[model samples]
Target: MASATFRATDAEIANPERGMYVWAADDLAAWTQAQADAQFAAGYRIVYTPVRLDRYAGEALPRKQLDALNESFATARRAGLKLIPRFIYNYPGGETGYQAAQDAPLERVLGHIGQLTPVLKENADVIAYLQAGFVGAWGEWHTSSNNLTLPAARTRIRDALLAALPADRFLQLRYPPYLMAWALQAPRWRDGSGASRIGVHNDCFLASSTDVGTYSEDAATRRRERDYVAALSAVAPFGGETCNPADAVDPTPRGDCDDILREGRQFGLTYLNDTYYRKLFHTRWEAQGCLADVKRLMGYRFELKALRHSPAVAAGQSGDLTLTLRNSGWARAFNPRGVHMLLKHRFTGAVVRITVASIDPRSWLPGTTSESSARFAVPAGTLTGAYDVLLALPDGAGSLAGDVRYSVRPANADDAVRAQGWDGMLGAFRTGTTLNVL
Candidate 1:
């Protein structure tokens, strides 16, 4: 994991340069489209979709929802985001708003579980984690007269939900104040291992004494919140932090979007998600502010080792290869668009050939990353033993392609998981010891 050393004070994620998730609206198309803009922006790289949970429970989720998830994922990928599902515990309508905290029925609210069970099982690839420490004003506040309060009872139910979730995933804790005084102790989790992945989600922007738009811009307010999160790193380890007012509204702002990120660095925050408000959802230009933030932070230095490919025993009509694509360097590589490397074959002469499909890498991690790969068959036959493999942009940009050292042989039965195809563009087949087919 990139964030293995991320202690209480570090940004608790593996790769913060691009580990950005956005809390989007309920509308699938709009959310996906908005994420594209967020991707173009510098900061928001990972996208948490469908802000409204009602549609997820009552509508799009009930259908074979994979296609919508695909479209949203595709949108995020195109916009350069690693897609993540932001699970909500309760839907908006039907006794959601204005209800007394004590009077609300836990089971009825918890009933959303049955609805989310299948969704999580099916879409865990893009799913980030369930959103907690939230309520009416959209799960962003703490200790207000707001909608959801982090009572022990509700948090226990949340722990149950996480128990039912799959492997290598995490939980994003939105409001950390209540978390420290009341939330974290509700559940116990030993983290970063396959059986015990646990984490937190925090942000510096919040409600204000002035206008909501003016919240983070306040001189005294931004500093206090920044220090508050920095302080939390000492106790509550935040895996992610989503800072808003990602905008630059001048007026002598002490720490703007850039500052929120620097805090993530100081506090050992691993994953960083961005929240886009309702008013600015429609504009592409508004998103560039986010894009710049991401680029600035992604400048971490890493030591890189080339991937080693398999030797060709025989060249048949079809086959595949798996290489030890090691991160020789200490740093990790994260995809801004989520699809980073493209494989290409150099033919005898100047004629170059490329893989029919692109390579979809696993979770953006650091140090000797294991790369699983697959390719198809050759129609006829050719001079086979050892062939050259080149790495570069997906489109073969001469200006962008990296070194050529990796090679591929054949794929084994243990490879290929239908579930793996759910996230990025995952469909490149490797035949047997021979050439590749479809």
Candidate 2:
């Protein structure tokens, strides 16, 4: 029997589906794999792309545009990045040639959703989540010339987006009241039902006391909305970026580290825009010495603390392995992932994989410590040799099951752990503990 304890590392990890994301507003037809690779090389694993549908406001999306959209997904997959995609009908100065912004009517919007459903389904593996867009200016669900923000119209759009998205994915709403209002009527949202798949994204985060109308202006109502968002974020995704601080209503220390970190933890923020509102992230946070913390703590950061296992076992016998870890980030993983243990023969290169079904990474909440153990059997007729042990946390999607790009790597600081622990090819972590099979 041997046991070892490890310490946490402060270095930034380029984990998937979390951290700061670069905003890509260019047409997907022009997106290049080289651009995506550059972003990934700079330590970003996610990109926030707005799919503008203004040209097709009155008609369905053409096959050419659909293929271009699919190519964007292929680019992300090739570059090892995920996307926070939003399909929008209009931008501020779009080619609609109207004084006021205009979005399609409810019927046309529904038709567009039907046309985009298949593409969304096919590339769902690379889509981190879809934003509930397609209304008003900038697809923010406000000030629609067609009055799409009206309760009846908004409900129809929400339902259609949910139905169009893949079942395993989440749809982020622009406003908190939309989610709160729906939860009141459905009640199932309080539990982990279909409603749980809906989450919140605030583009004007920390721009005011209420995030510039993202939350209620009324104090009591705002409290309730924040509470609900906190609860929903426990099981879903909550992320966004700061708007222009100069335009803030209550401009007193809004984007400071104290305010940002407090709200980040409360909302369980998963991702943020690295390119937007540089005053806060680039200047203020940098001068205040919290930019690094914000970068490392935005999403889930799992760090292994200790491990204990049987040092030797015989063929057809069982061996015990236990690991203690802590989630040191602001949020847990919102999507489903699998935990696995692998044993590889030192000379023969034969590997045995055992799934540790007892633990789910989504339940590993921020700032909490948890332990998981597995008793695996040494298969009959196994080679008698020293085997290297490893840990893997892989995406649950069948298409991405063995891809290391979608897997999670622990933040451990030991020299051996830092140097030899990560198996980028295998998407697993070497435990530094070997088991001898007799």
Candidate 3:
């Protein structure tokens, strides 16, 4: 057995930036510095908001709206919050106000997508994920006045959106059947390249027997939906909102904390709407005093249990680097993250980074301890000195490549290792271990 070295870290329960997200709408004013700072202070790291295109269904998005969106992204970045953006042209009961001439035509909708692609790619650093919207009322991909639900139309729009996004980010479809259909059309989706990035989102989660029609009414079909979602969620990101107050089980909160927690684990939920279902989380769940726990397990919470490695290493050589990490939160990091071992000179401020591709953060499921072993090597020409070992999980691309805001915070009580930058960037976390290079 290898020698064990324990890092000085306490298991405190108030780690932020993972659990709950505040819901924000399209208004640029709402995402101001004050508002976002308030959220950050409350331990929130994400904001769920919609980019409504109801006004620009036929033409390009007005300059005013686009500018507001850019401002919102900037505000979010300043406040150290990631954004979950959904682009929609309709809302609940949108059919009543839907007009054929003014309603966006298929061609115009595709045009809008083309227009939005640049903005998305530019801000990919701060985006958590994009919901496959641009169809149906409320962007749920259902109950639409336009023929967006048609197989051809839906496929065309979906393909365009997929092609438009940056390769690192994944898109979530509202329904499972639609995903199946898209997969069938694209054969290359079978190899986990495409399928691994596509996910599911159910707006009416746990609202009724069929989750308010999120799943199939038929027992057999429902089982298939569950199985399909489970498979996709294993590798991809999945999450959504609780049911509306008008749902069938409304006014009484459908299930207790146990039921909700069990189902969340079963579904592999990565995020949920904290602004909605106020009664369920505030009253029903809070009365039982499980609200904090529910928030704790909402998304991915990784804790560094212990790390073991060779005490002495040689320059220009390889050695075993082992890490014992645990996912104490409810879900995993649903996006592509890069794991690296960073070595910084104790006195000289020299730095060397070794990428570890073997550790895929997506596979780190909740309630499971993962052992990661990598053969780390120091470069050919290095000064003989003591160096600090650090761990960095960064987006690897975009403006926030080295920005600590996109990195994961290990839930440990070690102040030095877990400290963030003055601007709230995680930069890179220390490993509490040092190696001598000779």
Evaluated with TM-score, which candidate comes out highest?
2
The lDDT per prediction is 0.38, 0.83, 0.70
lDDT of 3: 0.70
TM-score (C-alpha, index-matched) for candidate 1: 0.48
Model 1 stretches with alpha carbons more than 4 Å out: 1-23, 26-45, 53-82, 87-104, 133-136, 140-151, 177-196, 205-261, 268-383, 390-438
lDDT of 1 by residue, 197-311 (tens): 3334544332122223423456676555445544444333344432233333442222344544454455544344444332332122135354433323332222122233333
The full ranking of all candidates by TM-score, starting with the best, is 2, 3, 1
**Candidates' RMSD to native:** 12.4, 2.8, 4.1
Using all chains and alpha carbons, the TM-scores for the candidates as numbered come to: 0.48, 0.92, 0.85
Candidate 2 lDDT by residue in tens digits, 1-438:
757677678988889899999975555556788898998889899899988888899887899988999999999988888999988776675434433777898899999988899999899988998988888888888888788989999999888888887777899989888887777632332264667888889887877778877878788998888888887888678898877645445554377778778888888899999877877554688888888888899889999888888999898998887888999999988777988877888999988776777778887889899887778677888889998888899987778877888999898764664333778778888877788889
Q: Which stretches of candidate 3 lie over 4 Å from their true place?
A: 1-18, 26-30, 62-68, 92-103, 183-193, 249-253, 344-354, 380-383, 415-428
In TM-score terms, candidate 2 sits at: 0.92
Per-residue error (Å), model 3, residue 389 = 2.8
Q: Write the per-residue lDDT of candidate 3 for residues 215-253, one digit (tens) a residue.
A: 777879888887777667666677888865354432334
The clash count of every prediction, one per candidate, is 52, 0, 3
Better of 1 and 2 by TM-score: 2
Off by more than 4 A, model 2: 93-99, 185-192, 245-253, 312-319, 377-382, 417-420
